[model samples]
Target chain A: MKHTVTLILLMLFFAVPAGVLVLISLASGWRFPDVWPAGFSFSGIALFLQQKEQILSSLASSFVFSLLTVGVTFFMCLVPAAVFARNDFRGKTVLEGLLLTPALVPPMTFAMGLHFFFIKLSLADTLPGVVLILAIFSYPYMFRALVAGFQTMGEHYRICARNLGAGPFSILWQVELPLLMPAVVAGGSVVFLVAFSEYFLVFLIGGGRVASFTGLLMPLLSSSNRSLAALLTLIFLLLPVGLFFILDLSLMRSFRKKGMA
Target chain B: MSWTNNRAGRLVSGLAPLLLPYLVLFCGGIMLTICQSFGVFTPLPHAGAALDAYAKILTDPAFFSSFGFSLGVAMVSAFCTMAAGTFLAYQVWQLPAKLATAALIYKIPLILPHISVAFVVLVFWSPSGIVASIAHSLGIIQTMQDFPNILYSGWGLGMVLAYTLKGTPFAMLLVLALLVRFDVRQIQTAAMLGASGVRIFFSIVLPRMAPAMHTSFIILFLYGFGAFDIPFVLGESRPGMLSIHVYNLYFKHDLARRPEAMAILTMMFFFAVIFIIAYSKTVQRLENGVRKL
Candidate 1:
C-alpha cells in the first residue's frame, strides 16, 4: 500500500507534466472538453523544420555563448579557487561569502547597472559582452566547485611535482588539470544551463542584436502558436539532457580506463 | 617581514583574476546603481535632490502593493515547495532500494529551465488547459469556461504553482542530500519507543532536516521574490512583481525615470542583503534556544 502510494505520487508529479507537454506539442487544435488532444498533427514539427535555419542558428548562438561563459569562468576561478582552498587568511569566510553573493542575489538587481557600464565600454550588444556578463554572474559556481576540487586533491600533488622539478605552470597543466576535470564539468554544466536558459540578461545587454534560443522562444511562448511553443520547449529540454548524458558516459569510461572508478 | 610580504603579494596576485572582474562588474555595477538612484549617473542631467527617487518610490502605493504581492507569492510558494519537498523526500528515502532509485524521476523538473516550467504550468492549468478539459469531460465543470480562472485571479497563485513546481525538486535535492547520511536505525528506535509517527517526525527527523530546510527556504524564497522569468509568464500587470516593475521602469518608460528603476533595484539589493543577515541571525538564535530547551 505504501509503495503504491509512492508510485502514484511520483507519477502524478513527474510523468504528468511531461506527458501533457508531449501531447500538446503534437496536438492540432487541441481544445476544451477534449480529455486528450483533438488529433495528432505534424504542424509543430513541420514548423520546426520549416524555420530550421533560424532556429538552429539561435541554438548555435546560445551554445557558443554558454560554452564561452564556461571557459571564461574556468579561467577566472582557477587560481583563486586554489588560493581559497589552500589558505586560511583573516576574513577568509567573509570574503568568500561576499564573493558568493552573486549566486544568491538576483541578477536583475546588478544587471541594469552592468548594462550601463557595458554601454560605456562598448561591450553592450556584442557576443563578448553577453559572455562576459554570464561569466561574471555565474563564476561563483565554478569557484566553489573548484575550491572543493582543490581541497579533495590536496597539496601533495603540487609538492610531489615540485620535487620532480616541475614548474608551477607544468604542474597545473599536467597534473591538476586532469583531476579537476570532474569539477569543471560539474560547474560548467550549471553555468551552461544558466546561460542557455537566461532570457532577460541577454535581451537587455544584447538589445535584440544577439540571437539566443531563449530570445527566439520567449516571444513564441506567449503567442497563439501553442504547438510550436511546446515543440521548442521540448527541444530546450532535450539539448541539455543529451549533453549531460554524453558527458556522464564519457566521464565514466575515462574513469574506468584510468582504473579510478 | 619579506617572507610575509611575498606571501601576501602571491595571495593577492593569485586572487586577482577572480577579483578583477568581480570588482569591475559586480561591485562597480552596484555602485553605479546606487549612484544612479541618487540622480548622479542619469543619462540626462538631473537637477533634483539625491533622495527624490527614493521619495517617489516610497510615496507610490503601487510600489508597496507590488512589494507586498511579491512577498506573499514568494513566501507561499517557498513554503509549499519546502513542505512538499520534505514530505516527498522522506517518502522517497523510506522506499526500498530499487523503488527509491525509481523515485529519482523527481529530478526531471530540476533540469528544466524556469521558463519551461512556467510553460508547463500554463499548459496544465490555464482555463482551457488540460485539467479544465478533463474536468469538463468528466462533468465536474459544465464548460471549459466554467473552469476557475486560477492563473490570472490576481493573487499570484499561478506564479506560486510554477515556483513550487520548479522548486520542489530543488528542495528535495537539498533535503535528500542530508537524508542519505541519516541512519534508518534511529527511526526504528524511535518507533520502538512510545512515540507516534508525527511525534517521531517532529522530534527525531525534523531537527535533522531543519538546517537544510532553512537554507533551501532562504534560497527558494529569495529566488521566487526576485526572479523575472516565471513571474513574467504568469504575473498580472497591475501590482506585478518587483522585477517586472524594475524592467518596466527601466525599459518601457522614458530615460528620465531611470533613477526610479535604479532605486527599485537598489532597494531590492539591500533587502536581499538584510534578509540574509536577519534570516541567518534568527535561525542561529532559534537553533541555540532549541538546544537550550
Candidate 2:
C-alpha cells in the first residue's frame, strides 16, 4: 500500500512541469509567490487562438520536417540491416561502426557545419535548407532499433510473405511493417522529440527569418512575462506531445482493426 | 531470383526518398560548411577562399580560452556524472521487483524538456534562488543577496552541476538498459564461491559495463561541449564559451566573419566525429573481448 501510494505520487511529480504549463495556459495569471494561478480564463485563450495561423504554419513545418526525418531514419537502418542479416560483406564491422557514428556526435556542432554549408549552397534561409540540415543527421538509437527489427524478422518472413502470393509491396505493407512498427514508433519519437526541441541548428540555419515556436520565444525570454512565457511554453510543448498521442491512437486503432495490433 | 530482385528493387525504391534527404543533409551540408570555412565571407560567399578567416580565428586569445573552458568543464561534468549516475543506477537496481515500475518513475528528468531543466537550475542555484532561501532561513546568510552567485561565476562549475543533474538520469537510463539484459547468475555464483559483492562487480560487472560506460561518457562529453541552453541562460555573458561565441559572431555581431565562425564549428565537428569513431571502436573492441572471454 505504501509503495503504491509512493509510486502514484512519484508519477504525479514526474508530470508537474507539463501539468503546470497546461494550467498556466488555461489560467489568466500566474504571478510569483502564489502557489497557483489566480484563476482560469478563455480571454487570453482567444488571443492565442488568434495566433493560430502563425502557429499552424510553424506546426506544418515541424510536421513536414518530422516526416522527412522518420522516412530517412527508416531506410538508413533498413539497407545495412538487410545486407548484414543475409551475408557478410567486407569491412562489415567497420560499416556497422560507421552507421552508429551519428548518435555519438553532438548535434549543435553538427548543426553549425550544416549551417555553414547551407549558407554556401544558398539554402540556408529556406525550408529545404533547414530540412537538408536538420533531418536524420544524428539518430543512432533509431538505427539500432530498426536494424535489430529487420535482422530478427529475417528471410523466413520474406519467404512466407512471398508464399502467400502477396506482392512485394503488399508483403512490406502487411508483414514487415507490422513487425517494424514498434521500433519505428519508439525510434521515431526519440528523433522527433530531439529535433523539435533542438535549438542551435534550426535557429542558426533558419537565420531568424523562419520563426519556429522556440525561435519566436527567444525575444520574450529576455522580458519573461512569466505568465505569458509559461503559457507559451505550455502550448508549444504540448503541440508535439498532442500530435504524438493522436498519431499513436490512430495508428493503434488502425492496426487493431486490421488485427495487426 | 527475379522475383527476389524485383522485391528488393521495390524496397529500394520505397526507401530512396527517405535516404536521399539525409545524404544531402549530413554529407552535402557538412562538407559544404567545412569547405566554406576556407572561403572568405563575401556577402555572396561565392567570391571564395579565405585563409584569413582561419588564421584570424586561430589567433584569437579569447577563442582559445573559451575552447579550453568548454572542454575542461565537459570533462569535469562527465566524470562527476558517471560517478553519480553509476551510484544512482545501483540504488535503483536493488529495488524490489514489485517496485520496478516505481524505479522507472525516478527517471523523469531524462524526458523532461531542456527548457524546464534550465528553469529548474535557475530557480535552485541562483543566489536569490532555493539554496539562498534555505541558507537564509538557517541563519547561515543574512539575506539571499549576500549568498553566492554561482550561476554566472564564469567558472561553469554551477552550470556543470545543473548539466549533471539533467544528464544523470539519461546516463542511468542507458545503464539500466544494459543491466536489464545482463546475466547475473554467474555473478551470484561467484559470490557463492567466496567473492565479495564489490569484487564480483569490479571484476565481472564493470568489464561487462565498460562499453556502455564509454559510450555514456562520450555522449555526456559531447552534450557538455555543445551545451547551449544551460550555458546560455546561466553562464556569464563575457565568459565566451565556444558555442556562445559562435552564436554571437553570427547573430549579435552579424559580421561577414560567419565563415570564421564556421572554421571553429568545423573544428568542433571534426573533434566530435573523431571522438564518436573512437568511442564506437572501443565499444566494438569491448564487445569482442567480452565474447572471447
Candidate 3:
C-alpha cells in the first residue's frame, strides 16, 4: 500500500508539470485554473503551421547539426578510447582524464573564444563551425560510452577470431562493429541531444545566422511571445521522447524474444 | 591470410574520415579556448600576448560578484538537486515495476530547454504569474498588480530552486539508471534483521548510489554554474551569474572589454574544474568506505 501511494505521488509530481506544459501548449489566450484549459483550440497548432517555413528551417538545422555532432564525436572518441583500451601506454590515465576536460570548462568561456577562433580560421558563424563546437560539447558522452563498452567485452573473441586468420579489419568490421553498434547508438543519441538543444554556442558563435530550434525559440522566453517558446518546447521534448521511445521499444522487444526462446 | 589482413587494414583506414572532422571541430574548440584564456582578448578571439585580460577580470569587483553569485547558486542548487532527487529516487525504488514507469516519466523535464523551463516557472510563480493570479482571485490582495518579481528578489532561492527543478529530473534519471543495476536482496536482508528504513538506506542504498549521485551532483552543478539560459532569463541583473557575465562580457556590455570577459571566463574555468575534481574524489571515498562496510 505504501509503495502504491509513493508511486502515485511520483505520478502526481511529474503529471502536474507535464499537465501544465500540455495545457499551455493547447490552450489559447493563457487563462488558467478551472481544472482544464478554459478555451482549447488548435490555433497554436495552426499558428505554428503558419510559421512552418521558419520552424522547418530551424528543425532542419537542429537535425543536420546533431547528425554531424554524432558522426564527429563517434569518430573523435575512437583514437583515445582505443589507446586506453589496447595498451598499457604511459600517461594513459592522465590523457584519458584530460580528454574529458571539455565538460569541466564553462561553456560561456568556450563560446566567447570559439567565436573569435572561427573568425581567425575563416569559419566564423558558419554551419561547419557550429557543428564542430556542438560536437566538442558532446565528446565526453560518446567517449565515455565507447570506452566503457570496449572495456566490457573481454579479449577472448578477438583472440579466437585472430587465430582463425581473421585480420584486424575483419575482426572489427564483422565482430566488433556489430557489437559496438548499441553503444555507438547510445552515445550518438546523447551527442545528438546535446547538439540539438545547445543554445549558447549557436547563438553566440553563429551570430544569429544559425536557426537551431533552441536558438530560434530562445528569443520569446519571457514575453507574450512565450507561446512560440512553448511550441518549440513540445518539439524539443519530442526529439528525445521519440528517440528514447523507439530505442526502448526495440530493446524490450529484443529482450522478450530472447526470453521466449 | 590476405583476406583477413585486408579487413584489418580496412577498419583502421575507414576510421580516418570520421576521426579527422571530429579532431578539427571538437578538439579544436577545447585547444583554442585554453589558449585564449591566457591571451588578452585583443579582438575577442584573437589572443594578444599580454595576460592583462586575466588580471583585470580577477581584479574587478563586478566580475568577482558575478563569479560568487554563480558559484553560490551552483552549489546551493546542486545540493537541492541531490536532496530532491535522492528522496524521489527512494520513493520510486519502493514502488512496483509498473509504477516505476510513472517515476521514469518524471524525467521529461530533462529534455526541455532552460529557457522554456524558466518561462513556465515564471508564469506559475512570479507575482503576476500563476501564483499571483491565484493570490488575486482569493482576495489575498487587491490586484495581482504589485506582486514582487520573483526573478530578482530576496526570494533569490526561488530561482535556485527552479534551476534545481530543471536539473532534479536529470539527477534522478541518472541515479535511477544506476540503481536499476543494484542488488536489492542485501537491503531486504537488512530489513529482515530489523534495520530501520533510514538505517538501511544510509548503510546500504546510499553507499551503493555514491558514484552515480556524486556524478549527477557535479554535472548538474557545473551546468548550474555555467548555465547561460536559466539564470539569464530568471536572475536579476543586480547579482549577475558567471555565465551571464561571460556572455555580455564578449557580446553586449562593452566590445572593448573582451580581455576582461575572457579573464572572468577563465575564473569560471577554475570553478568548473575544481568542483568536478572534488566530486570525483568524494565518490571514490564513498565507494571505498562502502566496500569496507
Candidate 4:
C-alpha cells in the first residue's frame, strides 16, 4: 500500500507537469475558466516544422559546440587529473578549490571580463571562441569526476604497466583509458549537459553570430506563443536526455563486450 | 639540482599545459572583472575615481533588495527541495528492490534544463495557467484574474517554484547516492528492538543521511542563488534577481555604466567565496560534533 502511494505521488509529481506541457503544446485556444484546452491543434508542431532549417541549424551548432567542449575539456583535464591523482603536493586542496570556483560562482561575474578579452583577441562571435569559453567554464565537472575516477583507480595500474616496460603513452592509451571509461562517460555527460544547456555564456560569447538552440528558444519562451514555447521546451529537454541515453547504451555495450561490466 | 627537485620541476611542467588554460581563462577572467570593477581595464577610459562604481552600487537600495530577495528565494527553495527530496528518498529507500527500481523515475527532472523547468512552472502556476484553470472549473476561483498572481507577485514565488522543481531531483540524486551504500540491517534491528519508526529515523538514519543532506543543501542553495536561466524565465521586473540586475547593468545600460556591472559581479564573487568558507566550516564543525556522538 505504501509503495503504491509513493508510486502515485511520484507519477503525479512528474507526470502532471509533463501532461500540462503536452496539453499546452497542443492547445490552440486555451484560456482561463477551462480545465481542458478548448481546442487542440498541430499548429505549434507545424510552425516548428516550418522553421526546420533555422531550428536544425541551431540544434546542429549546439551539438557541435558541446561536443567540442567535451573533447577539449577531456584533453585538458587528463594531465592535471593524473598529476593530482598520482601525487600530492603542498596547497593541493586549496588549488583544487580555486580551480573549482568557476563552477560555484555565477558565470556572469567573469563573463563580462572574458567578453572584453575575447573581443580583443577577435575570438568573440566565433564558434571556437564559444567552444573554448564553454570548455573553460564547464571543465571543473570533468576535472572532479576524473580526479575521483583516478582516486578509485589507484596508482597500481600505472606502476604495473611501467614495471612491465610499457611506455606512459601506451599505458595511458591501452590500460588506463579502458579503466577510465566510466569516469569519462560520467564526466562527459555532465560536461555535455552544462555546455548544451548553457545560455548566458553562449549568448555573451557567441554574440548571436554563432547560433545555439538555447538562443533560439529563450526569447520564444518569454513570448506570448505558449504552444510554440512548450513545443520548443520539449525539444530542449529531448536533446540532452537523448544524448545521455545513447551514451549510456554505447558505454554499456562496450563495457559488456570488454567484460568490464 | 637534487633529484627530488628535478622530479618536482618535471611534474610542474607536466601540469603546466592544463593549468595554463585555467589560469588564463578562469583566473584571467576574474582578474579582468576586478580590474574593470575598479575602472582600470575598460573599453572607455574613466576620469572618475576608482571607487565611484562601488559607491554608487553600495548606496543603491535596489542592490540590497535584490540581494535579500535572491537570498530568500534560494534559501526557501533549497530548504523545500531538500525537505521533499529527503522524505521521498527515505520512502523510496524503504521500498522493495522491485519498487525501488521503478522509483528511478525520480530523476526525470534532473535531466531537464533549468529553462525548461522554469517554463513548466510558468505553464502550471501562472495566473491564467493550468492550476488556475483547474481552480476556476472547481469554483475555487471566480475568474482567471481572480487566481492569485503567483508569478509576478514580486515575492519571487515563481523563481522559487522553478528552483524547487529543478533542485528536488538533484537533492534526491545526492541523497540516494549515500543511501545506496547504507546498510538496512540497522533499521531492522532497531525495529525489532521495539524502536518506533520516527525514533529509528532520528537516531540511526538521520545521522547517516546528514552529510548528503548538508552537501546537497549547499550545492542547491548556491545554484539557486546564482543561476540565471530559471530567474530569467520566471523573474519579474521590479526587485529582480541579482543576475537580472547584472544583465541590465551590463547590456541594457551604456558602456559608461560597465564599472557598476563589474562591481556587482565582483561583490557576488566575494559573497560566493565567503559563503563557501562559512558553509564548509560549519559543515565541518557539525560533522565533528556528530563524530563525537
- State which candidate has the highest DockQ: 1
lDDT of 2 by residue, A130-158 (tens): 65455555456676777667777778988
lDDT of 4 by residue, A107-184 (tens): 887778889999999999999999989988899889989988988999899899999999989999998988998899
Q: Estimate each model's TM-score.
A: 0.95, 0.81, 0.87, 0.95
lDDT of 3 by residue, A1-261 (tens): 887777676665555666677777787766533334567777777878888999999899888888988887877776556545665645545555555667556666566666776888877678888877777777888888887777776577788999999999999887776666678777887788778877877887776787788877776665574466667777788877897789868866765765731
The alpha-carbon root-mean-square deviation between model 2 and the true structure, to one decimal in Å, is 4.7
Off by over 4 Å in 2: A1-64, A75-81, A84-87, A106-122, A231-261, B1-23, B40-50, B190-203, B254-256, B289-293
Q: Tens digits of per-residue lDDT for model 1 on A13-123?
A: 977887778888899878877888769999989999999999999999999999999999999999999999999899786687778778778888888988888998999
For candidate 1, give the lDDT.
0.88
What fraction of correct interface contacts does each candidate retain? 0.65, 0.34, 0.47, 0.63
The candidate 2 chain B region of ten consecutive residues with least summed lDDT is: B40-49
Interface quality of candidate 2 as DockQ: 0.32
Model 4, which residues run further than 4 Å from truth? B1-5, B279-293
lDDT winner, 1 or 2: 1
For every model shown, the clashing-pair count is 0, 1, 4, 0
Candidate 3 residue runs with Cα over 4 Å from true position: A32-36, A247-261, B1-41, B44-51, B134-142, B145-149, B282-293
lDDT of each: 0.88, 0.67, 0.71, 0.86
Best by lDDT: 1
Q: What's the CA error at residue B87 for candidate 2, in Å?
A: 2.6
> Could you report the DockQ of all the candidates, in the order they appear?
0.69, 0.32, 0.41, 0.67
Docking class of 2: acceptable
In terms of docking quality, model 1 is: medium
